[model samples]
Target chain A: MGAPFNYDVLDLTDEQVDAEVRVFGALTAAVRRLNEATLRTTVDHATVEEVRRQVEELTARLEKSMIPDNFGVSFTKGGRIRGYGNAVVGIRNPNAVPLTVVQDKVNGRASAEFELNALHEGPPGQVHGGVVALVLDQVFGEAAAAGGSPGMTGTLTLRYRLNTPLGPCSAEAWVDRRDGIKTIVKGELRRADGTVTVTAEGIFILPRWAREEIAKNGGTPPQFE
Target chain B: MGAPFNYDVLDLTDEQVDAEVRVFGALTAAVRRLNEATLRTTVDHATVEEVRRQVEELTARLEKSMIPDNFGVSFTKGGRIRGYGNAVVGIRNPNAVPLTVVQDKVNGRASAEFELNALHEGPPGQVHGGVVALVLDQVFGEAAAAGGSPGMTGTLTLRYRLNTPLGPCSAEAWVDRRDGIKTIVKGELRRADGTVTVTAEGIFILPRWAREEIAKNGGTPPQFE
Candidate 1:
């Protein structure tokens, strides 16, 4: 038989990967718009039922393009994709906003930035509290990863300093302290004005999955999938 | 003029409330089904456009009704209806779930339970990890409320001991310790088999809003909302 249907076959150019990321973001924005319109209307059984039906149809249309059934992870001769499974825009997941996370060795620090859309709202005219925590967990985990331990967040503690508006925001994380599996990472999500709305401390664990996966890949960690 | 329209004045018999809860559960399940099918289908652009049109029509029809509009909290004189709002039923919110929290006589013991439907998925066959934390935070806050603090979560931490399966699950909480303003609480979410999928600890603070609300209410702690 021919070589297995590996991700290597679909070697995408850097430009193509960039385009994929953009498409995912646009689609997420569209979904958020639809959601807002639906919520702003009157509430009733019919409204509920109709929204459900319409959402069903929209979903069917969106997934028409069959990406590989496997999870988002890739390793090739070129480079590795990091922080690819973010719910909004991900290279491996066409459905999320595959955010590109980077660690700047020049500064020996980790930072990330991404745009938020309507799909992430919790209260009226505000982003969901949990989404803020999710991003914080990811950013903090990135910091932990910098120290050679990619992990799953074991405990994440967040204070909703304020109502985080839905729009462009940046997150930064730095290793504050470490005690074996208990890594204390401090992270913040800030607005364009540099006002911080969310702050977090997370304790992440070097789960068995990540440890084994790293060893199997010859020390090349498949970016957070 | 009639009292300003209070959004909290509808009443149902215990049986009626239970029935509404059941319907709410079913509708949430349908939303999930819609999400999964949408993610897996391969419809053409033209078909998707057509579906969008149908959705608009459904939206119009649903808006014509008023039940979901008239849903929310309610209080009345005697057993009869004085004012009424939808109390966790009436699909006014796609993401809404009814939480019933009961505080114990002891200073820091409390318990809560609620149902999750399709609108709360993260991974393929599991409850979204963030949602798990959301539920935990709310319950732990409720437990702190047991001590009559009526505080907000300053720092909430969760451990994903295992993947929480999609279906009926029970969660519980109790006071762990107290240090002045910070009331530490612990809780867990479990499947029917008693396997704890998630556990949490929270630091709750007696926020300014709560303190003021309590004082204005004649020092009697407000019941769970």
Candidate 2:
């Protein structure tokens, strides 16, 4: 009947949104470095313990005042989105593969070029297969949104053809077609050399609540995952 | 024919492995707190920048003398593993949901009890669907390994039956059967109250090299994903 929850439309200037993106994006990048170091570090135990205490103090400083809950998708009066907590592309999520997909609305396509480092390994040097799925799900969702019929991921299928090594990689997805309320999106994961490693297809459907809302109120739904 | 990259069987003792786990695991836990604060913090920009500088300095201290590359699965002489870089269960990986999966080799099953906080949110208070798949993939792989047929994931299929609310959750997976070199694993994600929210099936295949090594050289394969 209505939105699920927390898709708040806020009153903020475009400049304000851009500043949040910049400041928070930088913080996320720094935290990712700390994440990688947490894995790869060979510092002495004393130094590590010291760093832990320092980290705890910094975290406490930030936690002095905080949000009540998750940073849900927010839209500005100017239509700019602050979906910064997304698991795939969330600027604030260190756990993210941390990708930003470019949506080409005219062609119903989405693509992103990013790097997978030591933090993303699965079979030794290769990227974890689930991480690939995480990135694909978001990209495919964006493609559905770009196609002008946004929805939730109904089902995603992936075939691992080869190993995706830890390094620079790219992904491309486009809407194949639409079937009633469903949009079928096709995509592939590629190595830096442009060799395909995984191919995926997903069916995204307009949720019944959103569909009912649209039928009753008559407006396009939010174009986000 | 040999193991892929860095699954090195090291010469460390159980005590050494235990100490490393304690230290690195603590570091990861601290980093995770910083990660959450990075998102939830509402302090002034000056405070954010100063915290960022401190984080960078701490990370640098840890990275002084680090491993050359990915922390591939390593085994101690006493039989404990240092797969601390895993995405789902890696204790050293802050990006991980950081669960400690318990393997029941006798029953060819594996399970874990963990929590998903605001960081794992997708649909407002609900856990992200892709995050659900990520957890299932790891649990299914462990089940295959426990069943005495470790392998890479060939294909994983998931069905989201209901929204898994953010908070405490548990996952259980077991070997349903084996088809030649392939092990079929089935699992489900449950909310804190034990309600099933997502179901999954994954096909894990012992790679050709490992299979050939066993067939030609005559021994069981490694029992770890």
Per-residue lDDT tens digits of candidate 1, residues A1-225?
111111232466777656644544334334333333343344544445656655665655655664333233444345545223333333323223335567754432467778654434433234545566656665676677775555666677787665555678888887777787766778788976788987887776755654564576456433343
Query: Per-residue alpha-carbon lDDT of model 2 for A1-225, expressed as tens digits?
Result: 123453677999999888887887788889999999999999888888889999999999999998876776778889997777877888888777888799999999999999987788666677888888888888888888888877777777778777787889999999999999889999999999999988988888866654665566555566674
Q: Which candidate is the best by lDDT?
A: 2
lDDT per residue for candidate 2 within B91-167, as digits (tens), equals 88889987778889999999999988768866556677788878888888898888887888888877766667778
lDDT of 2 at B143: 87
Q: Estimate each model's TM-score.
A: 0.64, 0.93
Candidate 2: TM-score? 0.93
Model 1 alpha-carbon drift over 4 Å, by segment: A1-27, A43-48, A56-105, A108-131, A145-149, A159-170, A177-183, A189-198, A213-220, B1-32, B38-131, B145-149, B159-170, B177-182, B190-193, B209-224
Instruction: Report lDDT (Cα) of residue B151, candidate 2.
Output: 84
Report the lDDT of model 1 for residue B181. Answer: 82
